[model samples]
Every structure is written in structure tokens, then in C-alpha cells.
Target: MKIKYLYIGALALLSACTANDEALLPAGAVELKGITASIDNGSGASTRAVPEVKDAIGRTAFANGDKIVFTKIERTENAINPFIYSNIPYEYDGKNWNRTTTDPEKIYWTDGTSFHTFIGYCLPSAITTWEPDDKGVYPAELGAGKDEIDFSSLSEGNNEMAKEDLLLYCNKSALAASDGVTTNVSLTHALSNVRVIVNIKNFAASAIATDTQTKVIDFKLLSQPTRYTWGGGSNTLSVVKYADNNKKDIKLWCPQPDGEGTAQSKTFTFYGLTTPQNETYHGINGNNQPLQFSFTVTYPDPMNPNGSPLVKTYQGAFDKTVNFNSGQCTTLNISLNHKDEQMFLGAEYSDWSFVATPDLGELRKKSTYMTNVDETAIVTSGQVDNIDDATWLYHVGKKVYDIYGNDGESAAAAYCITSSLQMLAFAKEVKNGNTFEERFVRLDADITMQSSATAEDYQWKGIGEGSNVFNGTFLGGDRYINRLNGSPLFVKLGSNACVEQLHITAVGNVTNGTLAGTNAGVIGGCKVIDDVTLSGTPAGALVGTNTGTIHASYYTGAGNLVGTNSDGDKTGTIVGCYQASDITSFTKEFLTNFIDGTDGENPTNGLNDDLNAFYSNESNSKKFRTKFNYTFTPGSYPTLKVVTE
Candidate 1:
């Protein structure tokens, strides 16, 4: 197959052809010559099939030299041989596609034999054998390092990008040998371009030190065809190998050894986000196509410095379907707010742009299902769709002034709290005269409150304030609330309200000496507090004036775990719970009213793997069930387990 240099007019090529015609008087034999290539000058990657063939979107000159890989397959009336001829190297010097080796397979111009089909692809890629699938589609592999073509060069007609452009050419029809005749082969782009950009924002102060050490686990594009195929009777390029989650369901016959006695032909090159913009190539095109692209990014857990690494996953359905030509480019822009753990997606699709928008949920992290604000519009309805996840409620409302749509916690909805900002808003809402009542609140991520612990009287205003109290259930969801201070986390809790599965870590100045102000410990006042754990040195004095119930909890601080109400009867229920023996043991705090105001049983030493002070095991949590009129909810794991010595 040959194509004319559409741009240069390759006047020299014309002269060369004239010279060849002067002596090509072979009878009954067509001397195939003047074989060159040209490409479509539409919006896309350039073509470099023929030297000076600058029609490549008007941006290429084939300066790298005109080297084409041609393939010729015999054609019969019936079955087409899947593998007849392949990867025949041909060099074009402004005139003809001269075969690198003379006397290669030749098709005679006899009428009895069907003519052979001729096809050619530009140089710069590894040539593979002509192997067609059952559907007669020929697979194309751009291979590694061939992810994108750099079209930044603009030196009049010398585009460095032409070296990486992939152009395929197929003759219009099979021809029988006769007198010297010229055949034109038009080359077009065989791959589409995809550009991706991610912008990171609002990371934590310490995130830089920690996040840089993070590692990627696995990267995958769900349902993406691994193999691109073309020529299933037609010259249309398409995708194959729709795969499973691991992309291993449909295997291809890629026989390259992986050095481990296995084939290293599973998927295409996987790029990392080390840079700003990344471009990928594709062959699949359609409307309403389903795509799921995900990469595992490990970042430091903002709350737990030594805990587990946090991971983020990006998932699918950019649109119902997307229509694109072979040379089109698709761009995807992703913005991630690390502080809020939010992901926002945007897209642009056009002849000079891309059509990819990560839609479905409002700027929420789909990895942990952290943000689900249910209400009126999922995104716009002030009636309900919240910040996406337990979003930043701190900015949502002000101190005791913003109700945040809290018409009074109806049992129908539960607001999500993923950050300290949102938690602050909830606390203010309670003080704003909105008792949670039958409603609920969920903690999606571990929250670390920031405050000036150096202030002489630095105190956390705490959750419930003034005459307002948290009356609804606070579900901690096995997460932690860090940096508790001198004041109790909850200033007050209503009789029926509950706080459970919660961890309170006091890293600094929870209490300097005498437990702060009026009847305040780690928790100022509470009714039902269960499965809660308090840890860290200088831990806040816990549960001051607890006249309610304290069940199966652990307090490992050096201060008082529970204090008796100085005003009311020194009475409260502490069952299946434990406190640090190094401090004033909690068991002796009440001691059923110590006869000597000091005499008490030996401090109970509850031991466990984590805290070594507890109420988490079946024995500690369930043994007191019959004694305190409490019972486990069957199969639920005990939040804190204790073993006494």
C-alpha cells in the first residue's frame, strides 16, 4: 500500500516516479511503485507515513524517515487465512515502498487466483504477526511507553510527535497484477487520546511529612478492554477483552515471556500520579459507555500517626455513553480536598477537548461511604442532600446560632460527621435548642479537635452546652475523637440519650491538676455511656458526677475515671468497667459510700491486649449483664474487653 505526500507535493517523488516509468515496461506484470502514504488533516494526532506528508493534522513532516510495516494476506472466495503474511518492512524514499528483502511472497496477477489484500502501518511500534480472531478482527498493541504522543513541537513542519503517532492504512480493494499501476493507501489515526489531571488541595499541616511516605497498592481500570481490535471484515477499530474486576477473565494469546515462565501480556501501561497531567491512549468508542478507573493511594491517617494507612479509591460510570472518533481526546479533571476527604470531578469534551466527568455523587469520597446527606435534593435540595459525606458542618453553622436545618432531630434522618468542622456544627446545633431526640448522628472518620491547650484555662466548650443537651444517640462507629481537653466531651446528656463505641484520646493537658470546673471529668455529665475508652497520659478526669449508668467502659488515664455527684447522692451504676490502677481507682470513687471514706476492696486490675484496663471481653461485658439488668445485643463484639488480675 502507498500514499502520496499530501502536503509537500513531494515534487521529488513525482520526478522519481517519472524516472521509474521511463523503464518499467514489464509485460503482464504490475511493478508496484510510487507507494507512499497520507493521513487525514482533521483534529487529532499527526501522521508520519510518508516523508514530508504534513497533512498529519498539519503538524508533521515525517522527519524520522518514511518506514512502513506492510502486511499481505491471500484472499480466496471462502475462508481467509488468518495468518498468511505479516510485518513486511518497506522503506519509502519519496518514491516507492521498496521491500527491505527482495523475493518475498508475491501474489501473481493470474485471474484464477483471488488477489491478496495489502495493509500497512507506520513505523515506531513493534510489528506483530497477522493473527485474526474468530471474528476476523486483527488486534493492535501500542505496547508500553506508547501511552501518549507529545505534540508540543512546532518548528514549521518538523513535529517530534510524528515518531509516536500510529497510523494504519488499508488498500481500497484487492488488485490483480497487470501493467504498472499505482495504488493509494490513506492512513488514519488508530488510537484515541485521553488526558487526566488531578489537583490536590487543603491537606493537613503534617500531611506533607506523612503523605510523602505513602505507597500505592493496586491500580486498575474496571471493564476496560485490554486488547484493541480492528478489521473484523471492516476497517473499524474497536476494543475487546471486557474483563473482570482483576482484569483476568479474557486472556489473549500474547506469548511474550514474563521472565517467570509466564506471559507478561495482561494489561497496558499503568501510570502513576507523580506529575500533574497524564495522557493515555484508547481504541474503544461509543455512547453511554461504562468505565470504572481506580488506584489505591495510601496516605497517613491524620488521627493515627502509627495506625493504618488511609486509602482512596476512584470509581465509575462517567456517563451513559460517550461518542468519539479515533483521533479525539478526552480529558478528566479531578480535584481532591484531603482535609475534607472530598473528590470533585469535572470534564470537557470536544474536538479539541475531552468528555469525561466523574459524576453520580456530590463531592464525596466513595471509598468509605463516608458522606451521605439525605434530604431534599441529593445535591441542591436544602431540604436534604448534605455536604456529600458527614461533610464540614463547622462551616455549615455558627456557635449556638445555626440550627443547620435541625427542626428537631426527627427519627427519619441521621446526619454524617466526617470532620471536626461538622462535629462542631452538631454540637452547636444541640446548644441551639435542637435536642437530637429520636434522631441519630454517625461518625464517619476519626476526628481530631484543635485548640490552644496552652491557655491558662483552655477548655473545650464540649458538645452539649447551656440548658441544651444531647438527647439523641451518638454512634461513634468504632472511631476516635482525639485531643480531648480539661472540659468533658459532652457537657450534659439527657436521660434516654446514649454514647457508645466511642474512643476519647487526650493528648495534651486534659487536666493539669484538680479536674477543671463544676462536676467535670472526661465527660461532664451523662446518662448512658457504654463501650467508651479513654487513653493517653494526662488524660481528662472522666465522667464527673455520673449519677447515670456507666457500662462496660475503660478509662486508662492517670486521673479520676468517674466522680460522684457532689450535690446529689453519690450514686451511679458502674458495671463491667475498669480504670487505671495507677490512679485513684474508679471502684473506690463511689465505693458504695466508703465507710472510712477511703477503705475499699483492692483496685481491680482489668488487663487486655490494647489498654490493659477494660470492659470489652465477653466475660466483662456479659458477666454483668444479669447483675446490672444489661444484656449484649447477641452477636455484637464488645467494644472494650477487660481481664482483672
Candidate 2:
């Protein structure tokens, strides 16, 4: 096909034919002659038929829309020479090539005897797109170092041309014409073929039973070009720049088809691949980046029917060493198996109270007595004077007090005595002695020392001690135990404070060691019976809390594991509260708010509600369960295997 350059006025008049003479070429112009296409079957195992000039119906195989290129080979003796070409558009009716532009460089001339031979002619060119200002100069061959291609200017034309159609081929051997004569040329396919097949086994049963609902929905072959070379030269494959964020998708020939048996496979074909050079690509889109295959699977959640579908993605690396030679079909087989299990961040303890807040019962009663003025005395009768000298005593509304000292000056002894005095001053009823002991009071500060060899020698051994013990109506005192009779006993704790860990045989009120602030309760141990594994019945300290609060305290001897609290109660290194039994209630306006003690040190908003601890919807019951691994014995509750990372 040949296109006459659109020109006007004088130029048209000169080329126009009149009755007396035939149209003629301009003084320095050369005719484009005929164009041809040859397919290069020797390059690969596959062979493609040459496009016929006209099909059975007489319609041209490739005509008006096809492109023919004329290039000037800038030959050099030693260096590589890229083809410098120009566009000579084909017109449907015109049967011969012609130069329509008036530009001097756009025109080529031939020496009559042996027409100054034109270097080559290319049809179905790939260099269809060019910068407008470019003169149609395109690289003859692409080297490993060449990063980009500029096909616009051979002599500076501004208009751009894009080879919109897939590249069928570029003539392997350059074509030339002598004495204004024309010859036919053949072009070969520029791209190689590649095939990918995925086989799935046991389609009816998935390796991961939980993922049975998973089904492949989509697949993609990333980072392959759609077309190869443009201008005709050596049949070299076109090269493209690899971009990290950009990737071209290979067209899919088929999606997953219904399987007829236990195993099924689907095949996809992609064209325009480079020949097998046995090279490996690195990332999916960088130099030597291997081609990557990725697919999406839609997994239906059998456990949660109304939940959103789980879109799982699986990706694989394609063999970079496998090359796609011209017309060579490389098939890649991928077998689908169970996907690797994914891990998630997990918590160990159930109903793991994350924050500290007043227990529901405390909030319900709305009772706050720690700050009540008339309820607790603001001041004791008198300050404790010389401990060994004169005795000090005082009386409050319904309580009696006494002043005492430790027998030894050891640290433990000092802590006991000092703590005892602080507890008395907090009660605001220290007295000269245990006189008129209607309400007996003894400081058992040295209780921890009781385990020591000289424990019996420690002065002030428990409350209501000494010969001054209840004479008649005086309060009861048993060597090392406190006998408040019916009066309330206030115990204070100091460093190394120890509790006998005995079951609460009697009811009593326990509060902080000082009246300094709210929830100022001492950090120590008290007793409550619940279900425990060590004991045949519900009795061990770890069984569970039967009443009161276990807060800001850790046991050195033994304690229950996290899951041992089958009752779904809270237990950890932080403050937690359990409901009181009918036998006793936390009566001292208890502040189980040990968490609030640190103020803003902790970031948790508040403690987990005991009721909400369990995953169950039941109220007032702890049932929240963690997915973390745990061990469960026959009678014991589940115990978290690992609590911390």
C-alpha cells in the first residue's frame, strides 16, 4: 500500500498529470516501490503462514491500515548502528509508495542505472508511536543497557505515532530496491508464547478443613509486555523498563472450569514474551525480576454465615530461568495445596480484667466511708509518748486503745511497732494502756516475726497480749491471736507483712493501714474459700475467691493458674473483686480500687467487669475465653500455657 503525501498549490500542480503528459516524480524524489512481509520460522519451533495479499474473497490480507517503513541505515565500520526510519503511510487506492512531504530530508533519490538502493522496508511496524517533534528515528536493536526508546524523531517530526495493533513480525533480512525496482519482503512474529497451568488436588476436601469453603476466583501473570519490536532489523525482542509499582497483566485465556473428577486443572496462555535465555529475574518487576503469579480465593466462613467473605490471596514465583523463545510455548505447572497457617496476636487469661474500676456491688451501694468524717475519727486522744516510760491510752465512741513497743530493735521489730502505731493513729483512739478494756485493742505488728525462733520474745505479740488480759469483762486474748470480742479489729500491714492464710472463722472489717485517702486499704492477704484443685474440696487459696477483694498482692507460696478460676472470676497481678457470700459482706465501705492507687500510671480505661469476663452473654458470670493455647485437666480449669510473649 502507498500513500501520497497531502500537498497543495504549486507542489500539487507539479505532480498532477495532464492529458499531454503523465505524472512524474519531483527532481530529487524516490518512489517507495512495493512492500512485503516474511515470517521467521527458523527462529523458533512454531511456524506462521505469510499474510496473503488477498484472501479468498479478494479482500487484502493486510492493506490500508498496515504500515510500511523506510529507514536510512547509518552504517559505521566499528560501532553498532540503530535504524533511523521515517513513516510513509499507506493509502488504500495508491498501489505504489511516494513522498508527500516537501521537506528536503523527507525525500530520497535513486541513481537511474542502479537506483541508489534504499537500506530496507518494514511492514506492520511496531514503532507506531513517536513524539510529534521526532523525525521518525527508531533504535534498530535494543541492548541490555538501553533503558528507554524514543521513536518520534529521525529528522524532527512533532507528531507522535503509536503501533496500536499487536506486533505480527519484523522482517529478519533488510530489503532494498535497485533502479527504482521493488521486491517482496516477509516479516516474522516478534513475540514468544508462554502457558501457565494450575492443578488442584482433592478439590472436594481441602488440606485445612476450616478452609473448605475456599475457591479460586481470579489469577494474574504480572510483569510481561504485550508487544515486542517495532522497526524491522535483526529479529531482536523488544525490551521494556521494569517499574516497581507498575506491571502489565497478561491476558487470561481461561478461568477455573468446573472439575469433572477429584483433581482439576486450568490453563492460561500469554504472548509477547522474551526468548529463553536462562536468566533469572529478581523482584516481580525489576531487572531479572522473575514473573510472579498471584491468585485470589474467596473463603466462605462456615462459622460466621453473616460475616463478610474472607478474601485470601496467594502468590508464587515463576521460574526466571525458564525462557520464552520466539514461538516457543513454555508451560509452567503449579500445584495447589493447603496454604500456610497464619498466626495472630493472642491474650492468655480469660476475663483478663484490663483496667481497675469500682466493683458493681461497690458502685451499687454508692457507699464511701473512708472519707466520712463522723464515721471514722479524725484524731486520736493523744500522741504516743515514751513507749517504755509512761503508758498512753485514749477512748473513741465505742473503742479502746493502747500504746506498745517492740522487744527488739531489729528492722522487722521496728516495722511492726511503727505500723501498729500508724494503724492506731489512723483509728484515732490510742490509749495509755489496755485499761477499762470494754473494747480491747492490741497491736499484732510482729505477726510476720512469729515464724522466727525468738518470735515469742517479740514484745506486743498480737492484740490483747500480756497479763493485763481481760480480768473479768475485759476482752479476750490468746497468746498470738487477736480477741476483739465483738469490737472491730483494725490490722495494718508493713514490709514483709505475712498473713497466717487461715480460713476466716469469724466475720470482721478490713481496711487500709491509714486514713490518708480512699481505697487506702493495706496490701496484704485475707481468707475466702472457693473451688481449688489441690484440696479435695473447695478450699485452697487458688480454688477461687469466695468473697472480698484480692488486689495489688502476690502470693509467694502458691496460687491458682489463670484458667483455674472456673467460676469465671478475675485473677492476675492486678486488682480484682468477687461478689460476697450471704455469710459476710465487705462492710467497711471497701475500696477494691487498688488500680486507682497508681493514678494514671496504667493506660487501661478501667477494670474488666467480672460479669463480662466470660465470652458468654450471661450476666454476673465470668465466661470470656481466649483463643490462646491452654492446658485443661480433668477437674482443673484451663491454664494458659504461655501468658507473656
Candidate 3:
């Protein structure tokens, strides 16, 4: 789980520029000095740390052929915009100087004036200055939330995107020393840098280059902001890159170096990235989830190089919003985890293919148990294939129960069909009536049923009936839950089941009687299960193994949400475990309340790995808040709603 890091530092400014000694200097003119700045290599430049950062270098060191821009700052009528002046080409040769201007006097300046500098990558020849809005925010591009500086101009032909080196030193104070004038100035990065590194897990060097001929290409970043404002010649500018409606290729044919040490990975660097004044600006898509900046990777098919390319889009699980500070070099590591060839789409071409097979493919399957047939069901009978015949046992010559020949069997042992009527209807319509749809569809009915024999009325109105509930054997191993708004619920499943898009209110105990499935989803409103223990991946309030999208979902409770993988690693994700456009909401309270239990409280309580897992993991889900115009209510257990107003 690698997270982006923001590196910061200050470079001491040296005075070296001097006026032609023959001409008497202006009354208060100051001699210019040489500039000194160093890039802070986040990771040890010469050695590797546990969590390494990228290395920094001098302005002259543009590994990819980029140059630095130099200018001076002056006051302007626009309250929020800076006045850039005195553009010059100056250089520092370690200890000496080189001035590109024909007149040395032109480069020299008065003591009271301030200096401003930056890289010219994507900078328009003449910028259109405008007044700030009522909120002091300059106008943003039509689709974007803020005005972003367009670097798309740097795109180099059919297969190229924008990448340039940049630095900013604004409003640097200068004074004429009584003897010799020297100014103290520190240059910071005007744009943030994103280093996209690719890694293929469980892959050998031979397979990467020869067998799979793995070439990562067409690496584009979608939905990024495109306008910006250098904050009035200030040291730091609060900028916003308006979201682009379409995807843009920022890197073409990113290089793949032999991965070093354990996780063999390759790295590509994208420069001149702008950060937003509000780092949480995740543009809302049609489904209302925060839009994500997609990282699409394509490779040539070894069998059919001219055919459609093998593509895989990598989306981060939690932090969909880009967060970069001044002079920060952030890293985004994408790993192509190796799995069975049958699981990859291009496996037919090569045995060494690495692609995530289609699971739900942007389809969100949900049911309220209130309707026998939901026209909006994203999980159709077609998506439900590979029914396990062995589990579909015959009860008295009738295929009605599990191997044990009973109804309401512990979900751990089998896939329990919560609705008897719907099961019969679905089985009859099961493509050819071969098997029931269990692996994808969740069985959580909102029907009324007796809680216990001793009780007078039907208190529990959901999955599972009274005494004989857990007795029936389940088939086809789909995740099943018996829950009401806030009451205790029972959950059971087989290894491949994934629970998604179900809402639960109230403070109820969620008992995972069986730990068979690898994933689960908590879409809609759900209070954190009081007591939860399972071995597989436990996705929080939003989703488990989402291949499509999850939005407007949340969890609220005093209990702790806990579970870990077989290796004791907590693989609990909040949203977007396997696909893109998965949006999850978070607040200070969500982070503060849902802690792993402290005392003899919830067994899964007190765990703090959620923050890292949801935000820093490989899942493509974006984390956002109401302040960012994300339409959701706020509270101990907040709720998401349609913002009609």
C-alpha cells in the first residue's frame, strides 16, 4: 500500500548579478545574485528506505529535456492574481553565472522589488487576466471546478501527453546590502509532479519482456482540472485543475525498468501538475459518485498486435482526489497482480497475460426485498453463470433444499435463498433452468416473518425465519444476510460470493456465522455491524468487490468493523475494490467513530488500517465530503440522498 508523498524544502539564494561597473548604478539598485535550489529526493537517493520517496535535483537537471522559467512579481489590481514581470534567462553554473539577456542592466533591479519565477511549460504566450468571483475564486473552465493551467498543449502527436519541468519562486524579497547587495530567496515548485510506476506482481523479468511482451502504453489520466491562478505572486498559489470531461493522455509509452528488490516495478514521471485550493474536489459523475482520474494502460497483443489493444484501467480505492503541495513529488504505483490466464481477457493470445476478468462490469445489482422483480436489477440472470450443480441438491426428488435437505441452513455451509417465491421464479427463468443465480445476487428480503415461536407477531421483516432458518442447506454460494433497518442480522456465504448495494439502519449485531466469501459490499445506509468476524476481504459501508460503481452509501455505528485476510492482513476496503468510479464518503466523524473496539468490546474494533486501505490501496474509489459539494447528510451515522435542490 504505497501513498503519495509531498516533499518540501528551501534553497538559499546567492547574489551574483552585478550592473556594468562602468555605469553608475541607480540610487537604490541592487546587484543580482545566483539562485541555489535542490530537489528533495523523497526516498534515499543512494539507498532505499522502508517507504521510499522520489529524489529531487537542480533546475538544470531535467532528465526529460525541460527548462525553467524566470520572472519577477509586481502588485496588480486583481486581488487574487499575481503580476508577472521582467522575464529573463539566467543560469547558475554551480558557483558562477550566465545571463542570456543582452543588457546586464536590464536584469538588475531595485531593492524594494520582488522576484517571481516559474517554468514556461504550457504557459500561454499572453494570458487573459480576469477578476476573482464574489468568493475570490477566479473562473474555472466550463466543466472544471477551478481554472486549471492547460498543459495539454505539450502533447507530442498521436501517442503523447503533457510533461514538463517547472519551479516557482514568488515575491522573494530583495534588499541592497550597505557594502554588496545580496537577496535571500527560496524557490519552490510551481507545479506538482506525479510519478506513475508500473509493477507486475508474481511476474518474472522474462515474462514481462518476452513471454507477455508486456508494454504499458496509452497511459492517460482522466477528469483532471485544467485552469489555475498563481496566488497573486505569493509564495504559494491555491490552484484548482478543473475536471476534464474526457480522458487525456499525460504519458505515452511509459518506460518499464526492471523492478528492483521484492515488488519489481517500472517508473514514469509526470511534471507540472496543479493542485486545487480544495484538495477534495472530486467531480460528481452521473451516478453522483466522485469522478476519478483514470490511469488507462494498454499493451500490444502478442497474437494480434494490430487488433484492439489489451487494456486495463487502474483506479485507486480511496483517495480519488489528487493532493499535492508546493515542491511535492507524489508517486502513483500501479501493479498488475498476476492471476490465472483464464481470468484475463487477452489470455487467448498469450499464456503470460495479466488482466482482471469481468466480474460485474459496471453493473450494480440491488434489491429491497420489497419487490419480487426489480427492473433496475443490474445483476441479470445472464451474469449469473457457473452454477455449482453439486450444491443444488435434490430434496425428496425435488430440487428445493441443500445437500442436508433443509431450509435456512447456515449461510457458511451453503447459499441460502431468502425468498422462496423469488427463488422458484428465478430458478425457472435461470437462462435454461440449470441452476440458481447465487454468486452475484444478494438475498436480503424485506418480508415480514416471526422472530421466534414465543413471540406474538412477526417482528423481524427480512431474510431468515424462526427456528428452522439456519437448518436448510444453501446452494450456489451467494452472500446472504438476514437484516432489518437496525436489528441484528445473520450472514453466510461460500468462497466466491460478493455482497453489494444493500442498506441496513439501526444498531444491529451482524454475525458472520460462516466465513466463505472473498468479498462483501455495504451499499446504501448501514450501521457498522456490532460483532463481525470473518476471514475473507470485508469491504466497508460501500462495497466489497465492486466491478461497476458504488455511490451514495455509508455506515454509522458505535461498533467496530473488523476482519482480515487468511494471512492476518486486513484487506477491508471502503469502496472500488476492483473497478472504477466507485465513490465513498468520509468525514472527521467517520474516521473518529469507527475505531477498533477498545475494551472487551467489539473484537474487530480499534483497527485503524481502514484509512490506509481505503485511501492508499489500489482500488479506484474516490473519497469525498459534503464540503466538496458531494450531496450527502452529516451526522454520527450520516446518510446520502439525492440533492434535488
Candidate 4:
């Protein structure tokens, strides 16, 4: 019999010799096969075919012209197992398994009749005491039957055919044609022909084994014209020019199986835009896993198409997590756009936070004269033409009217014209048929009286005869009779008559007669225009005897008199006699010093003599004497003076 090896070494050697530039074989170039083999020792051997093996020896080394046969004449003892089984299948033709030997004794070879082995010694004759090698029996048969073999049908010295062919044929007879189908014979198939296989010889006795796996990937793409859009019923894919032709767009979707052997019902929804899209997947499981999608959008230039133009661009990324159990979803948003057609109302007045002025028309309508007037009936009225003139007249009228009806001559004169000439100059009409004489006469004159001058000097006629000298005789000397006791005078002075020198002297021992009584005084206390002088005992310059009252009288450069000395009883220069009456005297310091010695128990003879000489030397001694007496009242009476000097 001819002996042949499967040439597993050739597969490894071919892969090592090939360059990296070679192309990978197509998917159909790779195939999977099933195989069963047996091992036998002289004493006993076990044999079984490999389970789940496809094409059982049909595509392997024991097929067609290639065959593997071995025999051991003797059995050996004390050997160890040398073969290892793996759950994942080996890719033999691809050189995926390492072939370098750690021990030369573990490697074996044969040249038909002669065998080289690693684990046991072979005897030339059969012996019943034979033992198996480490991998079981000698020569280690690998199949249970002749047809249970796989092949690697590859062409000799053709490196491309080794990568592209799953089965190798030695001759045309080894390839058989059945009907129109062709079959190749080889020892082993190309590595690409083998399907991924897994074997589980023994499961964990204490625990059940299970597997779980997850994978996350990020996808990115630019715009593409041939992209397809799914979902939303029959909407076509949106196609637009993006960037230049240098970048091509790509899109992706995933299909999920409802269960094993069931058609995938829902295709994963995805989108590819005219712009670039980026997506990121996170987390182990789909639940609560974040998925981020990003895109860049470029708006066309409204002003230009082919040339350089203004463009509004947006680029951003967003992320959201999905809850599988609750079906809760979240999305992030970012956008930029122009919106110009919005309107808004300002805050209402009631809702405003600050104070403002009310409308002027509203305030004006509520204002009136009655509401703005004072208790005195005074109003703002309007601006006047002459404020200063109006104020002057207002103050003048106020001063003239005392609350009572008492007359105020000085304050009244400030408001109106006084003299007849002034009245005639301005007064248009007079009331009550009153003449200017009555209305505008000298209301009153302030006059000083003297005692030395005779009645003719004052244009007054004396009354009575002889010592009383009768120019025109009258009962009182110089004063009006109203100032004295109630006695009517025989002679009356003229209304406008002036009075000057008037004096009175004592007759003899006139005790009961009163001078200047309430109705018969020589000088009236109420109204007197002339001075009066008196001498000797019981003489008074003002009145012979004051029985009523006299007030507000002054004398200066005067001529007037009343009363006379009667047995040296009493005398006064200002008043001839004051009986139980009050008098006030005023004197300047200079005048008081000049008349210093006039007051004494007995007046100084030099002072009196000097005064007499001064009086007698004057041409109007009577007027001068009384005037000096009135202006400087003698120190005999109590006085109050408000004088600067």
C-alpha cells in the first residue's frame, strides 16, 4: 500500500511565504467539513467519529487520492496524552495555530513503511501485551469509516489557489462529476471554508454557564446624495449639495430581532442630512443609555449662489438618555434664527412701579375760584398790573380803621388828600354837600402858649375892667371855660381868634373862688390855643383853680393866664392852682440845670432875681414867662418825661 500525509505543513508554509499585499479571498472560498477518526492498540482501542462535523471527510486529507493509514505491531506502557482539544475550531489553512515545537521528541514523521513516533516504541511483531500511545492507539486513526474524511483540495504551487480554494485535487480522476456537479478531493479545506465552530465537552458541574455581551459605537458622516430616508411613510430622501464633491455622505441603521428565527420587524430609524452628522452611544445596555446626535447646518446665501456669499451656519451637539422600562425620553435643543414679527405691550399705569405726573387737563377741571379762596375772601385772582401800588393802598386803609369807630387822623391822611388845595386838585366829587372848608380844614393844630404878652398881641380882647384890663372882657383869663367848673362866660372868643398875653393876679384873700374850674378855667384841659401866666400867692398859670380835669396841654413862647395871689395861699407857673389833681411835668437836662435853684424852702434870691430880670427884659414877658413855665414845668409837681436830652 502507498502511504501519504495530509500535508498540513504545506498550508502553514504557504501562508508564511505570501506577501502582505495579497488580497483576501472571497467569502465562498472558505468551507467547513466534519470528520471522524479512530485510534487502535494491540490490546484494545477506542474509536468514535467527531460530532457535528460537516462533509465528514469529504473535504479533508483522507479524501480522493490522498489517504492516511497506520498500524502498531506492539503496545507500549507508561505513556501520556499529547493532544489538546479546544472549544473553538482551529483555522488550520490560515496558519492561525503555532507550529513551532518545544520538544523534538513530541514531533513525529513517516516515509511510508518506516514511522517516526514521539510517545511509544513499536515492535516488529504483533504482541498481545501492547499498550496505546498518549493520544490512544498507535498511528492514531482519526476516522471511523473510509468515507468519514475531510480534504483540502488545493492546486500545487499555486499560492492564489491555496487562498481561493477549499479543496485540493491531485489528478483529474480524483475529481468526479456527478450529473452536472463537480467534486474535489483534498486532505483539508482552506481556512476560509471553515465556519466558526464551538464545542462544549463538559459543562461546569457546580454552576450553570451563561454569556452576556454589549458593544457601543460612535457613527459620523458627511452629506451624501444617494442616502435613503425611511419612516414617515413615503417621504423621499432629501438631497442637497454639501461642501464639495470631496466629501461623501454616509448613513447607518440597525435591525433588531424580535426573537430567534423571527424576521426583524423594525429597522432602526436613522437620518443623514445634507450636513455632517455625528452620533455617540454610551452605556452597557440600551436602558438609560445616552445617545448624542450632532449636525452642522449651512444656509444658502440669499444674495449670491455661485460666488462667495453671506451664510448663516449652526453647529452644535445634544445628548439624551432613554429609559427602556418607563419609556421616558429627553432631548437637548440649541437653535439660532431671526424672528422679527413679534409685538409686545408696555406695562400699564396701575402696574407701573414709579410715580408720574397726572394729566394737566384733569387737574384743571377740578380747580375753581370758590375752592381756592381764603376765609378773608382773598383770592389769588390773577397777576395785577401794579402790585406795589395796590399793596400801598391796602396797608393805608387798614391803618386808618381801628376796630372801634375812634378817629385816626395820621393814618387816614395817608390814604387821602388833606388840604383844600390838594382836595381840589384830585377830588372829582364830594359827598353830603360838604364844603372844602368842612372836609379839608386844619383838623387840629398843635400850639404852645405863653403868658407875658397882652391879649391884643394874640388878637384876643380881655374881659372885665381895671386890673383885669378890658380889651374884651371875659370871665376866665386865657383858658376855655370848658376846662373849669360849670360856669358860663360872658364874653366868647371868636372861632378863629388867636390868644397871646394873658395873666391873672390875686385880689385880696380870695379863698372860695376857683380858677380854671371844670366849666370856667382860663385854659381848657380839652382844647387850648394860648399860654397863660400867673403870679403872687395862690397863682396858677394854667387855671385859677382846677376843679374838674385838664389833659394834653403844652406851652411854648406863650401868653396866657388865670388866677391871682390871694393872701399868699398857692401858686404855679403852668397852672395857677391845682386842687386835688394829678399833673405831669417834663424838662430837658439842659433846661433843668439852668433852673436848678428854682426849687427850695425859700427860692434863691439870685436865681429868682435872674429869672425876673430875664422875663422883664423880654418884650413879650407875659408870653415868655408862661411859655417857659409850660415847656419846663417847675419841680414842684410829679413828672414823667421821654426826652433825648
CA shift at 153, candidate 4, in angstroms? 99
* Residue 68 alpha-carbon offset, candidate 1, angstroms: 3.7
lDDT of each: 0.41, 0.29, 0.32, 0.21
Question: Taking the tens digit of each residue's C-alpha lDDT, what string does model 2 give over 35-63?
Answer: 43433333233121111211110011344
Between the candidate structures 1 and 3, which one is better when assessed by TM-score? 3
TM-score of each: 0.31, 0.30, 0.32, 0.13
For residue 256, give model 1's deviation from the true position in Å: 31
Q: Specify the poorest-scoring 10-residue window by lDDT in model 2.
A: 512-521
> Candidate 2 at 44: error in angstroms?
8.1
Ranking by TM-score: 3, 1, 2, 4
The residue ranges of model 2 lying beyond 4 angstroms of the native Cα positions read 1-32, 38-64, 72-128, 131-181, 201-203, 206-217, 223-288, 298-311, 324-330, 338-645
Top lDDT prediction, candidate number: 1
- Winner on lDDT (2 vs 4): 2
How close is each model in CA RMSD to the real structure? 29.1, 38.9, 22.2, 66.9
- Summing lDDT over every window of 10 consecutive residues in candidate 1, give the lowest-scoring window: 1-10
Task: Report the CA-based lDDT of candidate 1 relative to the real structure.
Answer: 0.41
Give the TM-score comparing model 4 with the true structure, all chains together: 0.13
Q: Which stretches of candidate 3 lie over 4 Å from their true place?
A: 1-163, 171-179, 184-186, 202-215, 235-237, 242-247, 257-278, 284-320, 338-645
